[model samples]
Target: MIIEPRIQNPASLLPDAVKAINLLYKAAHSAGVPDSTLELVHLRASQINGCSACVDAGARGARKAGETEERLYAVAVWRETPYFTEAERAALALAEAATRLADRADAVSDDVWAEAARHFDEKELAAIVLWVATTNFFNRINAATRQPAPQTWG
Candidate 1:
Protein backbone atom coordinates (compact mmCIF):
# COMPACT_ATOMS: atom_id res chain seq x y z
CA MET A 1 0.00 0.00 0.00
CA ILE A 2 1.06 3.57 -0.55
CA ILE A 3 2.13 5.81 2.29
CA GLU A 4 -0.77 8.26 2.34
CA PRO A 5 -0.78 9.92 5.75
CA ARG A 6 0.68 13.44 5.33
CA ILE A 7 1.59 13.93 8.96
CA GLN A 8 1.60 12.31 12.37
CA ASN A 9 -1.71 11.53 14.03
CA PRO A 10 -3.22 14.78 15.24
CA ALA A 11 -4.38 13.12 18.45
CA SER A 12 -0.73 12.50 19.32
CA LEU A 13 0.63 15.83 18.14
CA LEU A 14 -2.14 17.95 19.70
CA PRO A 15 -3.44 16.51 22.92
CA ASP A 16 -5.80 19.40 23.57
CA ALA A 17 -7.54 18.99 20.24
CA VAL A 18 -7.85 15.30 20.87
CA LYS A 19 -9.32 15.96 24.28
CA ALA A 20 -11.88 18.34 22.88
CA ILE A 21 -12.89 15.92 20.19
CA ASN A 22 -13.07 13.17 22.75
CA LEU A 23 -15.34 15.29 24.89
CA LEU A 24 -17.58 15.96 21.93
CA TYR A 25 -17.66 12.28 21.18
CA LYS A 26 -18.61 11.49 24.76
CA ALA A 27 -21.35 14.09 24.69
CA ALA A 28 -22.64 12.77 21.39
CA HIS A 29 -22.90 9.27 22.82
CA SER A 30 -24.59 10.47 25.97
CA ALA A 31 -27.56 11.64 23.96
CA GLY A 32 -28.86 8.08 23.87
CA VAL A 33 -28.68 7.50 20.13
CA PRO A 34 -28.45 3.88 19.10
CA ASP A 35 -24.97 2.66 18.23
CA SER A 36 -26.09 1.23 14.90
CA THR A 37 -27.82 4.44 13.92
CA LEU A 38 -24.79 6.52 14.87
CA GLU A 39 -22.49 4.26 12.88
CA LEU A 40 -24.78 4.47 9.87
CA VAL A 41 -24.79 8.24 10.09
CA HIS A 42 -21.04 8.38 10.34
CA LEU A 43 -20.56 5.97 7.44
CA ARG A 44 -22.97 7.84 5.21
CA ALA A 45 -21.36 11.20 5.93
CA SER A 46 -17.89 9.81 5.35
CA GLN A 47 -19.04 8.30 2.07
CA ILE A 48 -20.40 11.66 0.92
CA ASN A 49 -17.12 13.31 1.91
CA GLY A 50 -15.06 10.63 0.10
CA CYS A 51 -13.05 9.85 3.20
CA SER A 52 -11.76 6.31 2.84
CA ALA A 53 -10.38 6.08 6.35
CA CYS A 54 -13.66 7.06 7.96
CA VAL A 55 -15.59 4.80 5.65
CA ASP A 56 -13.39 1.88 6.58
CA ALA A 57 -13.64 2.62 10.26
CA GLY A 58 -17.38 3.19 10.12
CA ALA A 59 -17.92 -0.03 8.24
CA ARG A 60 -16.02 -1.93 10.89
CA GLY A 61 -17.99 -0.24 13.62
CA ALA A 62 -21.28 -1.07 11.88
CA ARG A 63 -20.26 -4.67 11.53
CA LYS A 64 -19.42 -4.82 15.21
CA ALA A 65 -22.81 -3.34 15.94
CA GLY A 66 -24.42 -6.22 14.03
CA GLU A 67 -25.34 -4.29 10.91
CA THR A 68 -25.76 -6.57 7.97
CA GLU A 69 -23.42 -6.24 5.02
CA GLU A 70 -26.32 -5.80 2.62
CA ARG A 71 -27.66 -2.90 4.68
CA LEU A 72 -24.25 -1.29 5.06
CA TYR A 73 -23.55 -1.61 1.33
CA ALA A 74 -26.90 -0.04 0.48
CA VAL A 75 -26.38 3.01 2.68
CA ALA A 76 -25.12 5.08 -0.26
CA VAL A 77 -28.29 4.41 -2.20
CA TRP A 78 -30.59 4.15 0.78
CA ARG A 79 -33.43 6.06 -0.81
CA GLU A 80 -33.78 3.50 -3.57
CA THR A 81 -33.07 0.53 -1.38
CA PRO A 82 -35.42 -1.39 0.93
CA TYR A 83 -32.77 -2.20 3.47
CA PHE A 84 -33.42 0.66 5.86
CA THR A 85 -36.31 1.65 8.07
CA GLU A 86 -38.04 5.00 7.78
CA ALA A 87 -36.07 6.27 10.77
CA GLU A 88 -32.76 5.30 9.20
CA ARG A 89 -33.77 6.90 5.92
CA ALA A 90 -34.56 10.12 7.75
CA ALA A 91 -31.20 10.12 9.48
CA LEU A 92 -29.43 9.42 6.19
CA ALA A 93 -31.27 12.24 4.46
CA LEU A 94 -30.35 14.60 7.25
CA ALA A 95 -26.72 13.53 7.06
CA GLU A 96 -26.65 14.13 3.31
CA ALA A 97 -28.29 17.49 3.65
CA ALA A 98 -25.98 18.63 6.43
CA THR A 99 -22.83 17.36 4.74
CA ARG A 100 -23.62 18.82 1.30
CA LEU A 101 -24.54 22.28 2.44
CA ALA A 102 -23.34 23.88 -0.82
CA ASP A 103 -25.48 21.63 -2.97
CA ARG A 104 -28.48 23.87 -2.48
CA ALA A 105 -29.40 27.34 -1.35
CA ASP A 106 -31.17 26.01 1.73
CA ALA A 107 -29.37 23.06 3.13
CA VAL A 108 -31.06 21.05 5.90
CA SER A 109 -34.49 22.07 4.76
CA ASP A 110 -37.56 22.00 6.95
CA ASP A 111 -38.90 18.83 5.38
CA VAL A 112 -35.71 16.93 6.15
CA TRP A 113 -35.59 18.26 9.67
CA ALA A 114 -39.23 17.39 10.18
CA GLU A 115 -38.65 13.88 8.98
CA ALA A 116 -35.75 13.39 11.35
CA ALA A 117 -37.69 14.96 14.18
CA ARG A 118 -40.52 12.55 13.59
CA HIS A 119 -38.18 9.64 14.05
CA PHE A 120 -36.02 10.94 16.89
CA ASP A 121 -36.74 12.99 19.98
CA GLU A 122 -35.01 16.30 20.66
CA LYS A 123 -32.06 14.86 22.53
CA GLU A 124 -31.62 12.07 20.01
CA LEU A 125 -31.82 14.56 17.18
CA ALA A 126 -29.17 16.69 18.83
CA ALA A 127 -26.90 13.66 19.11
CA ILE A 128 -27.45 12.74 15.48
CA VAL A 129 -26.60 16.25 14.37
CA LEU A 130 -23.48 16.31 16.47
CA TRP A 131 -22.51 12.88 15.16
CA VAL A 132 -22.86 14.02 11.59
CA ALA A 133 -20.84 17.15 12.20
CA THR A 134 -18.09 15.25 14.00
CA THR A 135 -17.93 12.65 11.27
CA ASN A 136 -17.68 15.34 8.61
CA PHE A 137 -14.96 17.08 10.56
CA PHE A 138 -12.90 13.89 10.63
CA ASN A 139 -13.68 13.26 6.99
CA ARG A 140 -12.30 16.63 5.95
CA ILE A 141 -9.21 16.19 8.04
CA ASN A 142 -8.49 12.69 6.76
CA ALA A 143 -9.15 13.67 3.18
CA ALA A 144 -6.88 16.69 3.42
CA THR A 145 -4.12 14.71 5.10
CA ARG A 146 -4.45 11.77 2.71
CA GLN A 147 -4.86 9.45 5.67
CA PRO A 148 -5.12 5.84 4.60
CA ALA A 149 -7.61 3.38 6.10
CA PRO A 150 -6.04 1.53 8.95
CA GLN A 151 -5.84 -2.25 8.66
CA THR A 152 -7.56 -2.51 12.02
CA TRP A 153 -9.11 0.00 14.42
CA GLY A 154 -7.46 -1.40 17.56
Candidate 2:
Protein backbone atom coordinates (compact mmCIF):
# COMPACT_ATOMS: atom_id res chain seq x y z
CA MET A 1 0.00 0.00 0.00
CA ILE A 2 1.18 3.48 -0.79
CA ILE A 3 0.82 5.84 2.13
CA GLU A 4 0.59 9.52 1.34
CA PRO A 5 1.34 12.37 3.68
CA ARG A 6 -1.46 14.74 4.59
CA ILE A 7 -0.09 18.25 4.21
CA GLN A 8 -2.19 19.97 6.81
CA ASN A 9 -4.66 19.37 9.59
CA PRO A 10 -7.52 21.23 8.00
CA ALA A 11 -9.58 21.36 11.16
CA SER A 12 -6.72 23.02 12.98
CA LEU A 13 -5.12 24.86 10.09
CA LEU A 14 -8.45 26.26 8.99
CA PRO A 15 -10.87 26.43 11.84
CA ASP A 16 -13.02 29.01 10.11
CA ALA A 17 -13.38 26.78 7.09
CA VAL A 18 -14.35 23.90 9.31
CA LYS A 19 -16.92 26.05 11.06
CA ALA A 20 -18.35 27.21 7.75
CA ILE A 21 -18.67 23.63 6.59
CA ASN A 22 -20.40 22.71 9.84
CA LEU A 23 -22.80 25.57 9.34
CA LEU A 24 -23.59 24.37 5.84
CA TYR A 25 -24.11 20.84 7.11
CA LYS A 26 -26.49 22.02 9.80
CA ALA A 27 -28.44 24.13 7.34
CA ALA A 28 -28.63 21.22 4.91
CA HIS A 29 -30.07 18.87 7.53
CA SER A 30 -32.56 21.49 8.65
CA ALA A 31 -33.62 22.30 5.08
CA GLY A 32 -36.00 19.31 5.06
CA VAL A 33 -34.05 17.26 2.51
CA PRO A 34 -34.27 13.64 3.45
CA ASP A 35 -31.17 12.12 5.02
CA SER A 36 -31.24 9.27 2.52
CA THR A 37 -31.29 11.65 -0.42
CA LEU A 38 -28.45 13.71 1.00
CA GLU A 39 -26.34 10.60 1.50
CA LEU A 40 -27.00 9.48 -2.07
CA VAL A 41 -25.94 12.83 -3.47
CA HIS A 42 -22.82 12.94 -1.32
CA LEU A 43 -21.81 9.42 -2.27
CA ARG A 44 -22.41 10.02 -5.96
CA ALA A 45 -20.35 13.20 -6.02
CA SER A 46 -17.53 11.59 -4.06
CA GLN A 47 -17.53 8.60 -6.40
CA ILE A 48 -17.33 10.85 -9.44
CA ASN A 49 -14.46 12.74 -7.84
CA GLY A 50 -12.62 9.53 -6.83
CA CYS A 51 -12.45 10.49 -3.18
CA SER A 52 -12.05 7.32 -1.17
CA ALA A 53 -12.30 9.08 2.16
CA CYS A 54 -15.65 10.65 1.34
CA VAL A 55 -16.89 7.46 -0.27
CA ASP A 56 -16.15 5.43 2.83
CA ALA A 57 -17.58 8.05 5.10
CA GLY A 58 -20.67 8.32 2.94
CA ALA A 59 -21.17 4.57 2.99
CA ARG A 60 -21.00 4.57 6.76
CA GLY A 61 -23.43 7.44 6.95
CA ALA A 62 -25.84 5.67 4.62
CA ARG A 63 -25.69 2.51 6.65
CA LYS A 64 -26.47 4.42 9.81
CA ALA A 65 -29.47 5.90 8.04
CA GLY A 66 -30.64 2.35 7.23
CA GLU A 67 -29.78 2.43 3.53
CA THR A 68 -29.42 -0.98 1.95
CA GLU A 69 -26.00 -2.25 0.94
CA GLU A 70 -27.39 -3.17 -2.48
CA ARG A 71 -28.45 0.40 -3.06
CA LEU A 72 -25.18 1.81 -1.77
CA TYR A 73 -23.22 -0.45 -4.08
CA ALA A 74 -25.42 0.51 -7.03
CA VAL A 75 -25.09 4.26 -6.61
CA ALA A 76 -22.30 4.35 -9.15
CA VAL A 77 -24.61 2.74 -11.72
CA TRP A 78 -27.87 4.21 -10.47
CA ARG A 79 -29.27 4.66 -13.95
CA GLU A 80 -28.80 0.96 -14.73
CA THR A 81 -30.11 -0.22 -11.39
CA PRO A 82 -33.62 -0.57 -10.03
CA TYR A 83 -32.60 0.12 -6.44
CA PHE A 84 -33.48 3.79 -6.48
CA THR A 85 -36.69 5.74 -6.68
CA GLU A 86 -37.36 8.38 -9.36
CA ALA A 87 -36.47 11.12 -6.89
CA GLU A 88 -33.20 9.43 -5.96
CA ARG A 89 -32.33 9.05 -9.61
CA ALA A 90 -32.95 12.71 -10.21
CA ALA A 91 -30.77 13.66 -7.25
CA LEU A 92 -28.00 11.38 -8.47
CA ALA A 93 -28.19 12.91 -11.94
CA LEU A 94 -27.90 16.37 -10.48
CA ALA A 95 -24.92 15.30 -8.38
CA GLU A 96 -23.11 13.84 -11.38
CA ALA A 97 -23.80 16.80 -13.63
CA ALA A 98 -22.75 19.28 -10.98
CA THR A 99 -19.56 17.38 -10.13
CA ARG A 100 -18.49 16.87 -13.75
CA LEU A 101 -18.89 20.42 -14.89
CA ALA A 102 -15.98 20.21 -17.32
CA ASP A 103 -17.58 17.27 -19.09
CA ARG A 104 -20.12 19.56 -20.75
CA ALA A 105 -20.85 23.18 -21.40
CA ASP A 106 -24.11 23.11 -19.55
CA ALA A 107 -23.21 21.02 -16.54
CA VAL A 108 -26.54 21.16 -14.73
CA SER A 109 -28.90 21.15 -17.69
CA ASP A 110 -32.47 22.39 -17.59
CA ASP A 111 -33.86 18.90 -17.85
CA VAL A 112 -31.87 17.69 -14.87
CA TRP A 113 -32.86 20.72 -12.86
CA ALA A 114 -36.49 20.28 -13.84
CA GLU A 115 -36.44 16.65 -12.87
CA ALA A 116 -34.96 17.40 -9.48
CA ALA A 117 -37.39 20.22 -8.96
CA ARG A 118 -40.23 17.81 -9.65
CA HIS A 119 -39.27 15.75 -6.61
CA PHE A 120 -38.20 18.55 -4.29
CA ASP A 121 -39.70 21.80 -3.14
CA GLU A 122 -37.75 25.06 -3.54
CA LYS A 123 -36.21 24.82 -0.03
CA GLU A 124 -35.34 21.17 -0.44
CA LEU A 125 -33.89 21.88 -3.86
CA ALA A 126 -31.73 24.61 -2.43
CA ALA A 127 -30.52 22.24 0.27
CA ILE A 128 -29.73 19.57 -2.32
CA VAL A 129 -27.75 22.02 -4.39
CA LEU A 130 -25.79 23.11 -1.34
CA TRP A 131 -25.21 19.51 -0.35
CA VAL A 132 -23.82 18.73 -3.79
CA ALA A 133 -21.48 21.69 -3.66
CA THR A 134 -20.34 20.82 -0.15
CA THR A 135 -19.66 17.22 -1.07
CA ASN A 136 -17.64 18.34 -4.09
CA PHE A 137 -15.68 20.68 -1.89
CA PHE A 138 -14.73 17.85 0.46
CA ASN A 139 -14.02 15.55 -2.50
CA ARG A 140 -11.51 17.95 -4.01
CA ILE A 141 -9.81 18.55 -0.69
CA ASN A 142 -9.48 14.86 0.09
CA ALA A 143 -8.30 14.04 -3.42
CA ALA A 144 -5.67 16.74 -3.36
CA THR A 145 -4.49 15.79 0.10
CA ARG A 146 -4.55 12.05 -0.54
CA GLN A 147 -6.56 11.56 2.61
CA PRO A 148 -7.05 8.01 3.71
CA ALA A 149 -10.35 6.45 4.69
CA PRO A 150 -10.90 6.06 8.40
CA GLN A 151 -10.80 2.57 9.88
CA THR A 152 -14.36 3.20 11.03
CA TRP A 153 -16.77 6.08 10.42
CA GLY A 154 -19.66 5.27 12.73
Candidate 3:
Protein backbone atom coordinates (compact mmCIF):
# COMPACT_ATOMS: atom_id res chain seq x y z
CA MET A 1 0.00 0.00 0.00
CA ILE A 2 1.18 3.50 -0.76
CA ILE A 3 0.80 6.06 2.00
CA GLU A 4 1.12 9.76 1.57
CA PRO A 5 2.62 11.85 4.37
CA ARG A 6 0.22 14.26 6.05
CA ILE A 7 2.60 17.12 5.52
CA GLN A 8 5.33 17.53 2.98
CA ASN A 9 8.32 18.60 4.99
CA PRO A 10 6.63 20.49 7.80
CA ALA A 11 9.96 21.98 8.87
CA SER A 12 10.13 23.80 5.56
CA LEU A 13 6.97 25.65 6.53
CA LEU A 14 8.46 26.60 9.89
CA PRO A 15 11.90 27.70 8.89
CA ASP A 16 12.57 29.56 12.14
CA ALA A 17 11.59 26.58 14.24
CA VAL A 18 13.60 24.35 11.96
CA LYS A 19 16.68 26.54 12.36
CA ALA A 20 16.29 26.63 16.15
CA ILE A 21 15.86 22.86 16.30
CA ASN A 22 18.83 22.41 14.01
CA LEU A 23 20.96 24.69 16.18
CA LEU A 24 19.95 23.01 19.42
CA TYR A 25 20.49 19.57 17.89
CA LYS A 26 23.91 20.67 16.68
CA ALA A 27 24.80 21.96 20.15
CA ALA A 28 23.72 18.65 21.66
CA HIS A 29 26.71 16.99 20.02
CA SER A 30 28.97 17.80 22.94
CA ALA A 31 32.71 17.33 22.73
CA GLY A 32 32.71 15.13 25.81
CA VAL A 33 30.68 12.30 24.30
CA PRO A 34 31.74 9.98 21.51
CA ASP A 35 29.91 10.32 18.19
CA SER A 36 29.37 6.58 18.07
CA THR A 37 27.71 6.57 21.48
CA LEU A 38 25.51 9.50 20.53
CA GLU A 39 24.41 7.65 17.39
CA LEU A 40 23.53 4.58 19.42
CA VAL A 41 21.43 6.57 21.83
CA HIS A 42 19.62 8.27 18.96
CA LEU A 43 18.95 4.95 17.23
CA ARG A 44 17.71 3.29 20.40
CA ALA A 45 15.35 6.12 21.28
CA SER A 46 14.05 6.23 17.71
CA GLN A 47 13.48 2.51 17.81
CA ILE A 48 11.50 2.73 21.02
CA ASN A 49 9.46 5.61 19.64
CA GLY A 50 8.74 3.65 16.45
CA CYS A 51 9.77 6.59 14.32
CA SER A 52 10.69 5.06 10.97
CA ALA A 53 12.30 8.24 9.67
CA CYS A 54 14.52 8.41 12.72
CA VAL A 55 15.29 4.72 12.64
CA ASP A 56 16.39 4.98 9.02
CA ALA A 57 18.36 8.18 9.54
CA GLY A 58 19.84 6.97 12.82
CA ALA A 59 21.01 3.76 11.19
CA ARG A 60 22.66 5.71 8.38
CA GLY A 61 24.21 8.15 10.80
CA ALA A 62 25.49 5.33 13.00
CA ARG A 63 27.09 3.55 10.06
CA LYS A 64 28.68 6.79 8.91
CA ALA A 65 30.28 7.04 12.36
CA GLY A 66 31.84 3.57 11.85
CA GLU A 67 29.30 1.50 13.77
CA THR A 68 29.14 -2.15 12.83
CA GLU A 69 26.07 -3.96 11.54
CA GLU A 70 26.04 -6.28 14.53
CA ARG A 71 25.94 -3.43 17.01
CA LEU A 72 23.25 -1.60 15.08
CA TYR A 73 21.14 -4.74 14.82
CA ALA A 74 21.56 -5.44 18.52
CA VAL A 75 20.79 -1.98 19.80
CA ALA A 76 17.25 -2.83 20.84
CA VAL A 77 18.45 -5.87 22.75
CA TRP A 78 21.74 -4.51 23.98
CA ARG A 79 21.30 -6.19 27.35
CA GLU A 80 21.46 -9.62 25.78
CA THR A 81 24.05 -8.61 23.20
CA PRO A 82 27.80 -8.56 23.82
CA TYR A 83 28.44 -6.18 20.97
CA PHE A 84 28.41 -3.13 23.25
CA THR A 85 30.98 -1.99 25.79
CA GLU A 86 30.22 -1.46 29.48
CA ALA A 87 30.12 2.29 28.94
CA GLU A 88 27.84 1.90 25.92
CA ARG A 89 25.58 -0.36 27.96
CA ALA A 90 25.29 2.24 30.68
CA ALA A 91 24.43 4.96 28.17
CA LEU A 92 21.82 2.72 26.54
CA ALA A 93 20.27 1.99 29.90
CA LEU A 94 20.08 5.70 30.62
CA ALA A 95 18.62 6.40 27.20
CA GLU A 96 15.88 3.79 27.63
CA ALA A 97 15.02 5.03 31.10
CA ALA A 98 14.91 8.64 29.95
CA THR A 99 12.94 7.87 26.78
CA ARG A 100 10.32 5.76 28.55
CA LEU A 101 9.61 8.33 31.23
CA ALA A 102 5.86 7.72 31.31
CA ASP A 103 6.32 4.00 31.90
CA ARG A 104 7.27 4.47 35.58
CA ALA A 105 6.69 6.94 38.35
CA ASP A 106 10.43 7.22 38.86
CA ALA A 107 11.05 7.39 35.17
CA VAL A 108 14.80 7.56 35.29
CA SER A 109 15.64 5.37 38.26
CA ASP A 110 18.68 6.09 40.40
CA ASP A 111 20.33 2.82 39.46
CA VAL A 112 20.22 3.72 35.79
CA TRP A 113 21.39 7.25 36.47
CA ALA A 114 24.16 6.01 38.76
CA GLU A 115 25.33 3.51 36.19
CA ALA A 116 25.39 6.18 33.53
CA ALA A 117 27.24 8.48 35.94
CA ARG A 118 29.87 5.81 36.58
CA HIS A 119 30.50 5.68 32.84
CA PHE A 120 30.21 9.40 32.08
CA ASP A 121 31.26 12.61 33.76
CA GLU A 122 28.87 15.56 34.21
CA LYS A 123 29.43 17.03 30.75
CA GLU A 124 29.15 13.74 28.97
CA LEU A 125 26.01 12.81 30.85
CA ALA A 126 24.50 16.15 29.88
CA ALA A 127 25.38 15.49 26.25
CA ILE A 128 23.76 12.04 26.26
CA VAL A 129 20.63 13.39 27.90
CA LEU A 130 20.45 16.19 25.36
CA TRP A 131 20.86 13.71 22.54
CA VAL A 132 17.99 11.64 23.89
CA ALA A 133 15.82 14.72 24.21
CA THR A 134 16.55 15.95 20.71
CA THR A 135 16.05 12.49 19.28
CA ASN A 136 12.70 12.24 21.02
CA PHE A 137 11.80 15.66 19.71
CA PHE A 138 12.57 14.63 16.17
CA ASN A 139 10.77 11.35 16.62
CA ARG A 140 7.63 13.12 17.72
CA ILE A 141 7.78 15.56 14.85
CA ASN A 142 8.31 12.86 12.29
CA ALA A 143 5.79 10.46 13.76
CA ALA A 144 3.11 13.11 14.04
CA THR A 145 3.58 14.05 10.44
CA ARG A 146 3.61 10.41 9.39
CA GLN A 147 6.89 11.06 7.67
CA PRO A 148 7.87 7.89 5.85
CA ALA A 149 11.33 6.42 5.95
CA PRO A 150 13.38 7.66 3.05
CA GLN A 151 14.98 4.32 2.35
CA THR A 152 14.92 0.70 3.42
CA TRP A 153 18.56 0.52 4.54
CA GLY A 154 22.01 1.63 3.52
- How many steric clashes between backbone atoms does each model show? 0, 0, 0
> Between 1 and 2, whose lDDT is larger?
1
lDDT of 3 by residue, 75-147 (tens): 9999998899999999999999999999999999999999999989998898899889999998998888888
In model 2, which runs have C-alpha deviations exceeding 4 angstroms?
Answer: 152-154
Query: Per-residue lDDT tens digits of candidate 1, residues 81-112?
Result: 89998998999999999999999999999999
Clashing pairs in 1: none
Error of 1 at 102 (Å): 0.4
lDDT of the candidates, in the order given: 0.92, 0.89, 0.90
What TM-score against the true fold does each predicted structure earn?
Answer: 0.94, 0.94, 0.94
List the candidate numbers ranked by lDDT, top first. Answer: 1, 3, 2
> Weakest 10 consecutive residues, lDDT, candidate 1?
1-10
In model 2, residue pairs whose N, Cα or C atoms come closer than 3 Å (at least 3 residues apart or on different chains), thus clashing, are none
Cα-lDDT of candidate 3: 0.90
Model 2 lDDT tens row, 15-119: 899889999999988888789989989999999899888999899899888899999999999999889999999989988998899999998999999999999
The better candidate by lDDT, 2 or 3, is 3
Model 2, residue 63: distance off in Å is: 0.5
For candidate 1, the per-residue lDDT at 20 reads 91
